[model samples]
Target chain A: MKKVLIAGASLTKVGDHWNKSLLDLAVEAGSAALKDAGIAIPDQIVVGNMFSGFSSLQENLGAIIADSLMLQGTPALKVESSGASGAMACNVADSIIRSGQANSVLVIGVEKMRDMEPNDAVHAASLGESASFTQFFGISQTAMCALLTHLYMQEFEISRDELSVFPVIAHKNAVPAEHAQFRKAITITDVSRSMPVSDPLRLLDCAPVGDGAAAVVLCSENGQTKNAEAEISASAASTDSLNFFQRDDMFDFTATRRALAKALAFAGLSIKDIDFAEINDSYSSVAALSVEALGFSKRGEGVRDAKEGKFDLNGKIPISTFGGLKGRGNPIGATGVYQIVEAYRQLTGTAGANQVKNAKTGLLHNMGGIDSSAAVHILRRVG
Target chain B: MSIAYWRERNRYYRILGSKCKECSAEFFPPVYKCRKCNSEKLAEQEMPKEGKVMAYTLSRDIITGFEDQEPMIIGLIELQNGVKMVAQIADASADQLAVGDKVKAVFRRVSVNGEAGQIFYGYKFVKIDK
Candidate 1:
């Protein structure tokens, strides 16, 4: 197998990008990643996005991005798996490198959300779930998470206040992150008191939607690139039932577990070797379920571990080091690539104030729907 | 949009799910293959109308088409045959509902396209008073 190295990484600040269109954000991030890779052209281009059809009424993104970047005639395509689109695109880029199909690939994940209304945006993002069974009756993805939250809390005997630990941690780390959306710190009480969107899920408990783009350059040994220091040690993906309630165990994030276990095996490293992680903390319940699935915490104990400072920057197995989906902001498909960019930053010793000490290895977990689709990746620093 | 829902009439109207002929296991919202025994031989089965609420949520983040049904109460209910499904809870406020409360599926109007559009119907759950 060929080695996939991170030749470049870049991201637009996550927020209401009323000034930029979807293609505009893609171009900005793509150009920066190209500049970072020190390459004038790439062997291939892959874009990851969700709901461009619904939100922007646009499609055929692969050709559009290649054309916008003025790199026409290069093979380009789009890969989408709802919220997991970003990491899934990277996974495809890795495959392209391993198969000797492309030596260097540009992977971009972008989303333009501010263009649509709140209700419409919710509907579009919820396309990740079942349409007939779940959405037909107007069930939003947040509602599905809400239903799961109630079950998880009831089964675990956990209170709503206790679940705020993950968001609090995310917000705290995001405070110093330059590209993060919610840079201000938030307290547990703040999370507990925020207006409720779905029962048991306060406004603070969910990741805010925004328009942003993130990009990365994957290069093989045969590719021409410079100033690269991290390699994708392992990449794996798996899927569970499209509907969360249909899974045999709602609390068990089977997709994440399978994907992470596979990734760890491929990397030949134990969970303890991971200095930090970028969790898909789109919601408090999701964050808890995700950490539990990653084996960073036992079932029903993710929030408890967070309260005890176990996931703190100075503690064992720090997560969401730059605020993650909650603190850093989520642009749907772009979020995973942002995590990859953040991981690359940490591995390159350039995370600034949010850096984990001696961060030699990192784990990134990104999922679509309610852990219905999952992708796990491991990145290692190279001297 | 109602035209899109025309094909699922049986599933929406009668709570028609699927049962595994091989393992005798059943599922709601149907399944292509048996989840229990992985059997492809499945039979169309009407689910028991009654079940207990496994969990519920009062969602104010209503989807675009569901604005009229503001702050909807959604529940995860386990039917008598051990099949689980999510459905809207009707005629019950959050204060009156509790986990383990019994609910039964009822035919109800789910949505309407507009003033002249078709009326879509589906099964929602109502709390069974003691």
Candidate 2:
């Protein structure tokens, strides 16, 4: 397989884009990517979308996006793995380039979640649950995470003060982004004051529903016609049981651990070798769990690391320099790709205000449908 | 009252999943097809009415069809049948709950679509009172 490099990337400010249709966002982001790469068109295109069928009541995204860009008949397709659809699309694009099937490919991830009412969106997302299992019992995603947070507390004796540290850091990091949704830095006291969404989880603790799109251009070494941000150092993905019940443990994500391990191994590095990271923070409790699972600290001690400012931009290893899904907004399918874009910007020194100091290697971790599927990628600076 | 086959079988108690004889994959609300191996051979199985609370949460922003049930405690419980299921946490405040705590099942009205609309009923878990 040939080595693949990211030629260009682009995105729109993530928020309520009610006036824009699904195809509009795709074209906007897709155009920005082509301009960034200095390429008019790619040999093939892949789009990542999770809920256009229900939220917008539309389908045939491959055709819609391709037609809008005036790149018709360029061999287009759509990739979906629930929330991780963006990263999944990137993975497919990379594979195509490495296999000599396509010299260059355009991978775009977009989700228009904020267009619908809050409850309507929640119900639509809940369809990811097993119809005969969790959905039949009427369980929603917030409740599912709240349940996991409660379990983690019971097992580790986690303190509310501990869970309080993540949002504090996230809001602070996101404040200067200018494009972030919740840009105001928060305090532990504020977290406690927010209304409870679920026991042990407050309204502020959950990621907000937002709309956004991100795009990446991947090409083989031979196809590089312009300077780009970075190269695909390594990437690994794994799957797990969709329902949380089948897993032997709630706090532990076997897929995440395995994928990270494989990724680190492929990159010929370890956790300590990573200069920064972007982990899935669909909920505050998840941020606390992922830092520990990624070997930043012990399982129960992730909260301690956050409290000490270990994950801040200037600390030992910064995480989510883009405010993450918590403060930046969770745009479902577009989230994972957005994280990679942030890392790429940081490594290339393109991040205006949120850039880490002389960063080299960065890690990206995303979980799809609770813990059912996971994708981890390692990026390096080559520019 | 007329109901779906799965709902009809669960009217007397909480719904349980049975694994297919041709494929040993268990399902909740019982199913005729095997999720794996796709075999018609199946066996009837009852879900344990009592289990340990594995995890839980309380949702404040309620959905449209479940506005009245706002701030509800939802949980994952491990049944004696070696399966885990998500259900509502009934009969207790958020503070009284913990992981691994014993809980029993009870039928309860989950939500009402409208003032005159159909009332949704399902099994909810309550702490086992000493």
Candidate 3:
């Protein structure tokens, strides 16, 4: 894979942005990234989002955001793969730069989820699942995850407190993360006792609904953007059964596992080379399954390992360094870009308190709809 | 029924799925290409109604249209012929459900468009007792 450089990166704090529209958040993050890169305009623009038509009552985000940024006539488009939209957009940007079609490409991942009514947001998010089969029955994504959560705990013989550890670690990590939505540290009891969205899966176990945007500017090996902080070594994505229950091994995060394997192979690196990871913890079970899929812990032991402090900032193979989807807040599609921006900060030594020691390599695992689709990218610091 | 559900009435009511001719593999929510043998030769098959509850959840965070069905119990069921599906676990409360409990399909109203609109009917699972 060509070493596409991350010349600039920026993000709006993940939380309720009552005063901003969808385009406002996109332009805010997009302009900051271009300014950081000292570029007047990118050769191409790519926006990653999910359910904008439902949340913002707006579509054609590509044209609208390009015009808003005053970069009309520039080639622009949008890519959506549910929650993996951001990483998938980045993957597209990397391919564009490597293909020599564009010298520089700007990728903006934005979502306006907080503006809608609570149930409407749930409905919008539910669109990520199979409409006729899953969503048609009124089982929201949270409900879908909850069904899996029950099986996971029961089959693995994991106690409630053990399953609650992933959120606990996420909250603790978010305490020092300035851009995180929830900065308050929490305990296992807090997670276990949180209001149940679906039985056995509490509110804290699920990622909070919020609004956010993140952007990154990618320049090719010899592109004019000279402010290269980190290089994207590999980008890989894979798909699984859209219905989680349909999969042969429901606990196996096939997409995440396959994507990570493909990404590591493409980068000529191994799991050992990854210093930290930014995995989608949309639910605690998803987080645990993803960690296990990434080979950080053995099967059915991801939560237990997390409970033992293995995924902490100072511990082995730290994950969700910036609170992840849980503590950092999940603006649906924007969460993946948030992971990339946070990883860029860690690699560039800009991560003040959430920084991992000697973090030379990082992995971003973004999944949509219960690991139905997954995108994994491995980033390494520039020399 | 809405036009969309009207079109898929057979699939909804009969559990119509795909069965690959080459590999003898069956799937719910039918696949275009057979995952087992990559066979495009497939036939529509009705899935077995008898199954066990692989998992279940009492869901409170439902989508807007389902406000009337607050806190619904949904189950992940594995049909007898070795196919998995998600169906509402009707006629049973959360306390009565358990993993590996036998269940069978029952026809029921799954969703309603509104007061004067369409009523989408489909299969719902009921416990087959201990």
Candidate 4:
């Protein structure tokens, strides 16, 4: 298979884009990425989005975005896997380029979540889980994560303060990120004292809803652009039971573990080889489970390690280099691509204050619906 | 929402799940195939009503049709037969709920489609006083 390289990337600051429409965000990010790559048009376009129809009353996003970008006549499509839509789109683009089907591909991840009412937005996000079994009972996604948090603490004997460290680190890292949504650092006391959206899961424990878009240009290894500095070494996806309660062990994120293992094997690297990581911390507990599943920490040690400064910027295997879902703002479908673009920034020495010194390799973990679906990508710096 | 809810009424009303005919292992919310033995030969079985609270959460951000039911308590209950299922904890306050507390299933209104849509009913759990 031919290797795929990220030629260029761009992102919009994540927040309430009351002035911008969904299509506007897409065009802005896509155009910026294309301009950065010095390409007039891409061979194909793939959009990753979660709920354009529900939030913006817009579907057929691919055609709309392509037409608005004035890149008509290109083969355009959209891929949705709940929160993992962004990474899934990138995976599709990678396959298209690796199979020699397309020489250049523009992958865009965009979402307009702030356009809808708070209740409607929560309902749309809960659609990521099972409609018949999970959502029928009217349990929001935050409630489910809160239950998982309670279980994790009870099972592993982890204290509330230890669990609160993930968001603290995320907010701290996000302070230096220009494109991050929550740039101000937050204290652990703030996380613990915040309003309880779901008991045991304060408001600060969850990623804020926002409008944002991120785009990346992918090309075959030999067809690199002038700014191309990183090659996608491995790309893989995996799935688990849709209902979190149905899994044998509710705390074990099987999809993340499977996908990350396959990605590392494909890249011929191990967990230790990863210099920096962009993990899916849509919720604080989810972040802990993700790191444990990815082998960065032993089982039941993820939150403890974070509290011990193991996941800090200068610590072993730095994660969430540019804020994360918690601090960076999670645009649902757009979050995965944000992670990819952030990794590209880290590997290319353009991460600014968030840069990890001598970073050579990085990993990106994005998931949909509490690890129901996950996509893992491994990238390495290329000269 | 009404059609899907009606189609699985038995599963919701009586806690009817699937039991593997080969191994006799049971599951809640049903399953396409046996998780234990991977056997497609499965039969519908009513799950035990009594269980224990393995974990629980109280949610203030209500979903659509659940606005009137804010601060809802949901729990993961482990049945007598080992099948685990998620359901709302009815008639209970945070102070009265705890892990390992005994609970029994009871039929109640789950939610309504909209202001004028059909009301969906399902099994909910109530703590059994010691």
In the order shown, the candidates' Cα RMSDs to the true structure are 1.1, 3.3, 1.4, 1.4
TM-score, candidate 3, is 0.97
How would you encode candidate 3's per-residue C-alpha lDDT over A1-383 as one tens digit per residue? 45699989999999999999999999999999999888888999999999899888899999999999999999999999999999999999999998989988989999999889988999888888988987778888888889888888888998988989999889989999999999999999999999988988999999999999999999987775575879899999999988877678989999999999999999999899889999889899889999999999999999888978899999998999989999999998888889989999999999999999999999999998889889999999988
Error of 3 at A50 (Å): 0.9
Q: Candidate 4's residue-wise lDDT over A1-383, tens digit each?
A: 79798898999999999999999999999999998887788999999999899899999999999999999999899999999999999999999998999889999999999998898889889989777767888888888888888989888998878888999999999999999999999988999899889889999999999999999999886566575789899999999988787788887899999999899999999888999899999888999999999989899999989988999999998888989999999999999899889999998999999999999999999999999999999999997
List ranges where model 1 is wrong by over 4 Å: none
The regions of model 2 sitting more than 4 angstroms off are B1-14, B19-42, B91-102, B108-121, B126-130
Candidates in order have lDDT scores of 0.92, 0.80, 0.91, 0.91
Q: How close is chain B to the truth by TM-score, in each candidate? A: 0.95, 0.78, 0.96, 0.95
List clashing residue pairs in candidate 4.
none
Best by DockQ: 1
Q: Fraction of true contacts kept, per model? A: 0.88, 0.64, 0.89, 0.82
Clash pairs (backbone) in predicted model 1:
none
**lDDT (tens digit, per residue) of candidate 2 on A1-383:** 58788888898888888898778888999989888887787989988878888788878888889888999888898888887787788878877897899878988888888768888788666666665455544567777777778778778888887788888888888998865778999999898778887777887888888889889888887776786668877778888877665676667777788888988998799898899999888788888878876888787888888888899988998988989888887788888778878888988998888989989999998887776778888999985
Scored against the native two-chain complex, candidate 2 gets a DockQ of 0.51
Model 2 chain A weakest 10-residue run by lDDT: A129-138
Question: DockQ of candidates 1 onward, in order?
Answer: 0.85, 0.51, 0.82, 0.78
Candidate 1, position A119, lDDT:
93
**Residue-level lDDT tens digits of model 1 in A294-339:** 9999999988999899999888999999999999999998988999
Q: Evaluate model 3 with DockQ and give the value.
A: 0.82
lDDT of 1: 0.92
Best candidate according to lDDT: 1
